[model samples]
Target: MKFLIIRFSSIGDIVLTTPVIRCLKEQVKDATVHFLTKKNYCGLVENNPHVDKVIVLNESWELMIHLLQNEDYDYIIDLHHNLRTWKVKRALHGVKSFSFNKLNIQKWLLTALKMNRLPDVHIVDRYLETIKSFGVVNDGKVLDYFIPQKDLITKDDIPLSHSFGYVGIVIGAALNTKKLPVHKLKELCDKINFPIILLGGKEDKIVGDEIAAVNEIKIYNSCGKFNLNESADLVRNANLIITHDTGLMHIAAAFKKKIISVWGNTVPEFGMSEYFGKDQVSSFKFQVSGLRCRPCSKIGYKQCPKKHFKCMELQNVEMMAVKTIELIK
Candidate 1:
């Protein structure tokens, strides 16, 4: 069987689809898996053993469609059920395609009306539902993130202070609404007794610097210093991870790292929390409950929809630091 699994952008969502790829390849007879994703995310699956071919979505839509038509895949599993994915399905009209349920309505109820109508299942389980027809069952494994040998960080790459072991603090999220304020981050850093390494993309360097300034010797700002896979390497080597609701949190789950994920405008009840499959790694969620405007948005915004920003502002950073200390021991 020839399968084309499509999950186009973003780090965490793409990482969540790994089990589907693995199950299809392992359980099915003569299965060949081809993954389709945006060019920026091709690296995430390029090293995946289960993926036979990785098709990149670039600027040329016609060319991308032409390439897909030629592959003649027997099945199309659409994990990202968006308009673009719908167009891809339309382009390959004759092929049998199954889409993952996005549950947008359920999410709207939770975020807008504060109703608990969403299912109790995790997003990974829902992604697996799309491949049920093929009898592909999840193999009870954690998410996969394969770092290329060239992108691997050496001991010399990180500070000597962190060589022994350090707590990785992911100081950035996709939006400001999903992250702690710069002052709050600094306060948390000041309280952590253990050595800390702040992780994020280049966009987060300035804020990471502000947080690390709390104690330059104890906190190493690694935000702008590394690429995605290199950052994953840092997460892999960490003693524990303290993160916002972002991609690196999911990557830490892939590495089975002990995680304390801090939530802001978004809540873990959205079902995108750190997953361990069946692993016994410790996981913690820190979110302010009882606020009607807690989960203000399903995704997030540049700034708080409400000017107060209590979802993050009300968080007890001191308590979180205490938890971090206990977990490290």
Candidate 2:
């Protein structure tokens, strides 16, 4: 049977879907798997060993739908159950499809009413559950991130000070409230005893510079200097990763790197966390507890809605640094 798995965008969410891809490919006899994602994120799955073909959604939905129609897939696994995926399933006419429950209502209750109705299951497990009818199991495989040879970094690529090893700190997040403030990041950098590499995109270059400015010898700002895969290469080579809830966190899980995941606006109860399948991995989460207004959004906001920003403002940097040191040791 031919399966077209649909997850349109974003780095982490796409990475989380790898287990389903692997199970669908390996367990099912004579099964072919194709992935649909935005053109920009094609690199995330283009090098994946499980995906037979990656159908990129260029700016043209009509063109993409035209292409999907021809594939004549036997089943559609809709990991991204947004309007776009619904439209794609509709456009396919009669192909049997299974969509993972997004639990938006549960998310809304958690964010609005501060109620915890979400299942105990992680998003990765929920993703695996979508294929239970196909008799495919988790297979105890964690997430997959394949770095191409050209994107791989050598010792020469990093600073001489970090030639031995460095902590990979993901300094950027999709939203402002989800990020550790500049002061907090600077504090974390100062407190960490190990060599540090600040990681992010072009948008974070200024903040990276600010954090690395304190001690150029101790902290090296590599944000905006490398592409996505290259950044993943850095995470792959790191001794551990310090990050907000972002794509690199999942990538770090893919590499099974020790992680200090700092939580802010979004809580881990929403089911996104460092998942290493059945493999044992050392991961620590830091979040200020006892805030009534915590988890203000399932995603995040430009600025703190409460404005006190107490959720992030109250985090214990010294303890987080100590934990990082302990994990590294």
Model 1, residue 266: distance off in Å is 1.0
Local accuracy of candidate 2 as per-residue lDDT tens digits, 134-207: 99988897899999999999988899989899999999999999998999999989999999999999999999
Clashing pairs in 1: none
Off by over 4 Å in 1: none
**What is the C-alpha lDDT profile of model 1 across 1-329, one tens digit per residue?**
99999999789999999999998999999999999999899888999999999999868999999999999989899999899999999999899999999999999998889998988899999999889898878778999999999999999998898899999999888898989998998999999999999999899998888888789999999999998999999999999999999989999999999999999988888899998898899878898988888788988999987799999999999999999999889
Off by over 4 Å in 2: none
In candidate 1, what residue range of length 10 has the lowest lDDT sum? 131-140
Query: Each prediction's TM-score against the native?
Result: 0.98, 0.99
| Model 2, residue 272: C-alpha shift (Å) | 0.4
